[model samples]
Structure formats: structure tokens, C-alpha cells
Target: MSTPGRGLHGRVLDTLGPAITAGEYPAGSVLRTDELAQRFEVSRSVMREAVRVLESMHLVESRRRVGVTVLAECEWNVYDPQVIRWRLAGSERPRQLRSLTVLRSAVEPVAAGLAARLATPEQCAELTECALGMVANSRGHRLEEYLFHDVAFHRVVLTASGNEMFARLGGVVAEVLAGRTHHDVMFEDPDPAAVTLHVQVAEAVRARDAERAERLTREITEGALQELDILAP
Candidate 1:
């Protein structure tokens, strides 16, 4: 998050954000603005602005005359999507995946229940369509196609919940889904049981069966957690 700016600041933030998260600049390491400016062929002002963005993420601390210092892993705002992306891109991926799965488990089941209670007929129909698309893509061994529908299904659940805070988390849900696929954590051939459960959940939401919606959603997230466990080294 580079202060919503343009050009050099974005470039510097892009280059350095992941690098720091990936431990190229490990905890407590100092980043000299002059050195970074020279290395990136940018002006000092631009480099300082970039550092300010990193500081906002709590990845680093800039002090007058003390240079910008990389903070400990615990100090970062891990929920920030940029931070999560950087961690996913690094060796810390397994831990990040587990953390995100825990979050998904905690939120999505409740969202599904609320969707059942609150979603309009049109929203419900779209959710069902997404679920059906997932089943079709899974049967065809189309992993990427399956992922698109899968992401849509979850996004619909959140949005249809009629809760602004929960709806706002759709981006986070999308990131986790895409991240799993990108990291090859997702099965190449989608799980048949998982596909069935998705359809069941969609139907439950359509029928306004809150209990079934919640239960089925929990089952889906549990399956995901199990996969993460199996993949964990």
C-alpha cells in the first residue's frame, strides 16, 4: 500500500514490500535511504516515501538519523493483503496458509448462515450457478476454471450475508483461494466430495436453511484445513 500514489513510489514499494516480507531484509536490519535511492536509481524523496508506506504496514520503522529498520515478523500487520501476498511468495507460505485457513474457518460458516437468512433470490441463484460451475469444472479436470467459480461462490456468500464488515472481507477470501491454487496446495483434480458439499451449501442458502448452510460451510472449511494439514511439512 504505497499511499495511493504513482510512478517511482509505487515502483519502490513494489520492489521492497515483498523483499522485506520475504526476509531479504530480515528483522532489525537497517535500510539506508541513500543506498536504496542509489541502488534503485530514484531520488531520496521517492525512497523516503516508499519507506513511509512500509512503516504503515509495520514492516519497518524510520527514525531521524537512525535509518529505516526492518521490524520483527510479529510486528507486521499480517492481515494486510500485501503482507499476506509477500509471505505467500516466501518460504513462510505453509504457516501463512494455515493462518488464513483458520480465519476462513472462523468467518465463512457464519457468513453462509447469514446469507441463507438475508440473500435475495437473484443472489441465491448466482451462488447456485457458481457452485454448479465449480462442479462442472472439477469434473472436467479444469483446475483454473474450477478456481474461478470457487472464488465466486465464497465471494457471493460473504456479500449475500448483508453484513458490511463480512462483505468487506471478500478480498481476503479471494486471496486465500487464489493463493492456495498458486502454491499448488489445491488438488489438481478437485475433490468430488468437496464439489458436492459446495452444491449442498448453495441449495441450503437458496432454501434459507440457515443451519444446513452453516453446517455445510463448516464441513467445507474443515476439508480445506485437513488439506493444509496433509500438505504441512
Candidate 2:
């Protein structure tokens, strides 16, 4: 989820971010910058910059002499896509995916309702196009393509809701969708019913039927939950 860590400091985060999220460094664990510099073979300056990035993410806090202390998970900005990506790759995958699906269920239905009422003509057109792209890629080992459209479709819906809070979740939703496709129990073709429901949700949004849009979105999220139970449990 991070850019390729070719930059010196970037390389440190590429290792440390996931390792911290994966619990390699538990809460309250203290790491000396000098030791980390030696281990990663980076200069002290590069290591310090990496620690600063982690601090910004609330993953760690650096002090003058106390070294870097891993923060409690509750302090982390879990919405960061990189944190989600790392968790989804670790032993925490099942739990992380479930939590994110539950979050989507709670937020997306309401966002779709708002989108139906507030979306501009241009947004409506974009929704239909994304829905069609999803349809075209719904079968025959085309998950990567379907995922592209699915993420776009939801991003547009959340953005068109006219709430900046909802709009900010687009990346979170994208990570969840990508996790489902690339890391979760989804191995076969996407559910046709889910695809159909997305198209219907788009139709309802375009028609400005907020109630219908909400209801259809609820169905989509419920189906996602059902898939987790049936496929992973």
C-alpha cells in the first residue's frame, strides 16, 4: 500500500510499518535508533526520519534519549491504507477483514442514500460507467478488472454523498475491496447477485430514490458479510 521503498527513509518504513502492525514490536516496546540504523544499514538521519513518519501515523513516539516507543494500537490511525494493508497481510487478516466489512456495512448504506439525494449529473454518469465496468468484468477470472470498477463505484458513491467524512473513507473502502479480492477467501468468480445489486444501486441513485439506494446498498454489504461466513468460517 506504500510506494516502493527505494528512498532510504522509505525503506525503513516499509519494514517497520508492517512489523509494528503485525505486533513484532508490541506496545511499549522501545527500540534504539542507533540499533535500528545498524540493523537496516541506514544512516542515523534516515532512521530518525522513518521514526518521524511512524510518529505521524501514531505508531511510535521518539524522544531525545528514551528511544522510540511503540504506541498502543488504540493510538494508531487505523484508517491509514498502509496500516490496513499490513494487517491484512499478517496473522490478523481474518479479524481485520471482518472489522472492515462491518465498517463498510455501517457507513456505505447511509452514504449511498445521501449520494442518491445529492449526486450531480456528472457523478450519476460516472456511477453508471463504473457499474457497467464491473458487470463486464464480473466473470471468467477477471477479478482484478472487476475490483478496479468496484472500488471506483464505491469511491464515487461515498464522494457524491456530500460529506467530507464519508469522502475520506474512499481509501479505506478500496483497501477492504482489494483485501477481499487478493487476500480473503474469495477465489472464484464474484457473486453475480452482488454485481447485479451494484448495478441496481446505481440505477436507484441516478433516479434519486434515496430509499431504494440505501436498501440496495444494505443488501450489497450484507452479502459481503455472508460471503465471509460461508467462505472463511
Candidate 3:
């Protein structure tokens, strides 16, 4: 739950958010701000700020008379990057990764098709550059670098789609890709065929081959799902 670059309030969120998503505080559970502050050894103000952040994510609702009530998972903004990160950090990570991959399967192929049709020359260049980066880092235990390009590749595809809704999923896609790399589930080297597929998708998009782009992107996401199934802990 603890990563760098977080302030005091963010630290509280780092701990508390993962706990909530992990069901340590189940749905309908009421949490007192003051008690939580005391338990975390933080001031009430910090706790309040943390609670406010969670409220925005619909993970909890603050009631004046009552307390912060944990909402059901159905009500959560699962696409929120922070929420996605917290979920990936928790015990439910395998399921979380699978669910996110399924989401990509649903959205990214269409996005890829649109990118093929609408991508600007600059965006197409970016896609090719990202693909080359992935190829460069796919082996020799260069996972972190490969992950960077992988996340960027998907983000470029989404943004080039000319759809704001799909574009906003950049962060969601980022968290999922980072989760797979950081968590122990991935292979030492990324799957070779998967890397090749990314390159092909990039080429298809650059060529303005909408149908091929969509099909290749579908293959990428399908491989991700299969990866989760094969690598599930």
C-alpha cells in the first residue's frame, strides 16, 4: 500500500484505501473519522481529507449525524485510477487484473479501430515509437521499461480514437498495465508473441488499416485475459 510521492494525507489514503477495497471494512461498515485518525496516528484534519477523497470515489459517504459509511462495490468508481491501484494492491488482485483486462477487451479494440481511422501523423509516429520501445525492453529482464512503453502505447491508441470517454480511460489502462508488471504474476520476460502483436497493431494503425488494427488489438487484450488465467496465483 505504501509507495513513494505521497504526502501525509496520501499516506492515510494509501493505507485506508487498500483496506477498504480489500473488504477489511466491508460494505455498510461505518467508520468514525476521529477513531480512524487515532488509529492511524494522524490528525483528524488529515483523516477528513482522506475521507473526502474516498467520498469522491464513491467508496464511502460522509453523513453528519452518522459516520463515513462504506458503500457497496457496485457504487464505487472502479475506473478511478487511485481506486484501481488500491484494488490491485489488495488481496483481490488476481480478480482485479482480470476484470480490468476484460474491460480493455471490451473498449480497446474499437478504440484501436477509431485510432486507425483518425490518428494524426504525430500520433501514428508516437504509436510506432512506443512499439519500438516495447521491443527494445521486452527481454533481458527489462520489465519496467517495457511496461512504460506498453502503457504509453495503449494510451496513444485511446487518445487517438477521438472519443473523450475512451480517452479518459488512459489512467485506468495505465494502472492495469503497471499492476501486471509490479505484481509477481507476470512472466520474467513478457510473452514474445504479445510484444509482436503490439508492433503489428502499431503498424496497422500507422497504415490506416482500421479492420486490421481492431483485430490485432482484440488479440492483444485476449492474450491479456489468457495471461491472467495462465498466471493466476
lDDT of each: 0.87, 0.91, 0.90
**lDDT by residue (tens digit), candidate 2, 129-221:** 999999999989899999999999999999999999899989888888998888766799998999999999999999999999999999999
**Residue 14 Cα positional deviation in candidate 2, in Å, after optimal superposition:** 0.7
Total clashing residue pairs per candidate? 0, 0, 0
The deviation in Å at residue 121 for candidate 3 is: 0.6
* After superposition, candidate 3 runs with Cα above 4 Å error: 1-8, 41-43, 230-233
Predicted candidate 3 versus true structure: per-residue lDDT over 9-122, tens digit per residue: 998887788899999988999999999999999999989999999999999999998999999999999888778888887798888878878888999999999999999999
Deviation of model 2 at 173, angstroms: 1.8
Q: Please, what are the lDDT tens digits per residue for candidate 1 over residues 183-230?
A: 656656888999999999999999999999999999999988887773
Write the number of the candidate with greater lDDT, choosing between 1 and 3.
Answer: 3
Give Cα distance to truth, residue 92, candidate 3, Å: 1.4
Per-model TM values vs. the true structure = 0.90, 0.91, 0.86
Better of 2 and 3 by lDDT: 2
Overall local distance difference test of candidate 3: 0.90
Ordered from best to worst lDDT, the candidate numbers read 2, 3, 1
Runs in model 1 lying further than 4 Å from the true structure: 1-6, 186-188, 230-233
- The count of residue-pair clashes in candidate 3 stands at 0
Pairwise TM-score winner, candidates 2 and 3: 2
Look at candidate 3 and tell me the lDDT of residue 78: 87
